[model samples]
Target: MKYRYFLILFTFFTILGACNQPISQTSKASAKKVINAAPEKKIPIDTSKAFKFNDNWVVPKSSLDFNSLGDSQGDTLKLAVCGDFVYSPFGTIKDSSAFSSSLLKNFSIVTRTEKMDNGTFNFQILNHGSSKLIFFFDTDPEASRHSDIFKGEIYDEDVQFVNGIRIGMSFPNFYKTLFDSFPDDLTNNYTVVQIISCVDDIIQTYDFDAGKLKSVKFITDSYWKVDY
Candidate 1:
């Protein structure tokens, strides 16, 4: 009877040891996964409020000469509105009529017009090699009467900012350029930047991906400042 009791006690302890080993190993693996998991990013600034102007805040502009990119105004929306054309790198594109213009012969200019409750909306896509420029126009009779708002998205390197900023620039250089030109804490320590021009009533966002300037978006303030 004494020998049988000793054998039973040894078997029970051996089973307990085996069970505890897996538990210990599993806990270690879970801890390692937690450590290796990708960290979450902080919440971005409230862009809707950013679009609105504060009493103390003024619009930010570029530090370099507006003419550095050749055209004095560059490809600014303001120029497109007041001047009735976009001074694109490929050419000066005026309106949706560009589909049949010389632009189509040299490059592809895809255009589409849609009817809306407000009025007619026109969109143009200018394809140049691997890059492209997309433009939106409010072709409503009354809308165009007031201002020629040329909302554009640029994937090309040739679309220059009046402040001399360009697409495909290094992220550090883009940040530094904005930092030196703008007088605000908002432009500091950011790989991406958004500038709202109250006078122009336009919002421009510069984005960076993989440490390089990716794309630039130009939109009207009234279009984005809403409860979404």
Candidate 2:
């Protein structure tokens, strides 16, 4: 009878120990899962001084006119004015011999050569002037491709387009301001905004992807007609 009582006590202790073991293991597993599933902290963005300006702040003007502006207009467009400038078939007019000298005087040129699939070559001039102007050119001399400014980009706040349109302006503000200033030049398909200049035979395209001004492109009518 004593042995039977001892056997019953052993069985009771064994079951209690099994229950306690699972309880402790389950608690540890739950704690591990909680730690693993914890969300990571995120850094907050400060927007208080987002639109503040520094000393180099350039107040954008209202509009730019080709006829009235003279050589200043040519300087702004990075194109050579009439006088001794030779016109290229690609729509660029400059004294090719004096091109390097002129660029040296005005811009710090960083040239990048790129080869095309058709065995032709091209050059990209980055940070051309204070406006961060980028110019694309055909580099091959033997080929019909003229060494001319095929494309240009402007992203500097100091360089403003017609009617206060600038680099950092919001899409809504730019569109509204541009339309308010030059209503005739504005055209949009909701995806792209374009300001066409019949006088220069050039189109200035504004790309506002992230609700802000992303980039501005100036392409010749020849390019827009043939390639674009």
Candidate 3:
């Protein structure tokens, strides 16, 4: 009888040991899976004063339709302007018959600086035959060896006019904002800032003698360069 009891106890212990072995294997597998999981990549948050200036600067939107004080002349042949110093191919020479001869130019994005800062960008007005137009840079470039011929790509001036024009700016000097600001990792070519612009037909007018000219506005699909 004692021998039989010993045999039963031995079998019970063997079964228990077998069960515990699998538990150990399961725990090891679970730990290994957790170790293989990836960690979240960290993004460098921009907290600089220069970026704050962009807050005060009016990032122009497509909805900012250049308005007119009154009806912009009905049935008159109108020409639309793009944000990137581009004009409608339709000459504003003021002649209905002139409509018969018109060429379309595609809109493209080009960088321009504002009149306020004469540094890399110059905020200047262009006087094309008595009509005045404003130009500003979407991108603020750093001091370059060459003239601020921006590194950002530009739409060729030769392209034909399309339905709309788009303009955007990239701040290449995102890290140079301030002292306490997080250091900018130059290795990562990041787009720290951006602005999108579109061009649309604005209020038309005649000689300044009839000067009711309020503003010129237009619509665009995206940044002038996004040629899809």
CA displacement after TM-score superposition, residue 45 of candidate 1 (Å): 28
* Regions more than 4 Å wrong, model 2: 1-150, 156-159, 181-189, 222-228
Q: Report the CA-based lDDT of candidate 3 relative to the real structure.
A: 0.30
Per-candidate Cα lDDT values, in order, are: 0.48, 0.45, 0.30
lDDT of 1 by residue, 1-228 (tens): 999999999999999989877557788999999988969885454333222222323222232112111121222212112111122322444565654553334446666665656666665656655545456655456542222234556566755554456778886566565433322443333455555442345545567776677887656644422110
lDDT of 3 by residue, 89-186 (tens): 12331222232343212222233443333334343222322223333333435622111111122232232222232121122221222122332342
lDDT of 2 by residue, 80-122 (tens): 2221111221233343344444422344556555555555443
Top candidate by lDDT: 1
RMSD of each: 16.2, 18.0, 18.6
Top candidate when judged by TM-score against the true structure: 1
TM-score of each: 0.40, 0.32, 0.20
The parts of candidate 1 lying over 4 Å away from their true place are 1-107, 129-133, 138-153, 156-163, 175-188, 199-201, 209-211, 220-228
Clashes of each: 0, 1, 21
Q: For residue 77, give model 1's deviation from the true position in Å.
A: 20
Ranking by lDDT: 1, 2, 3
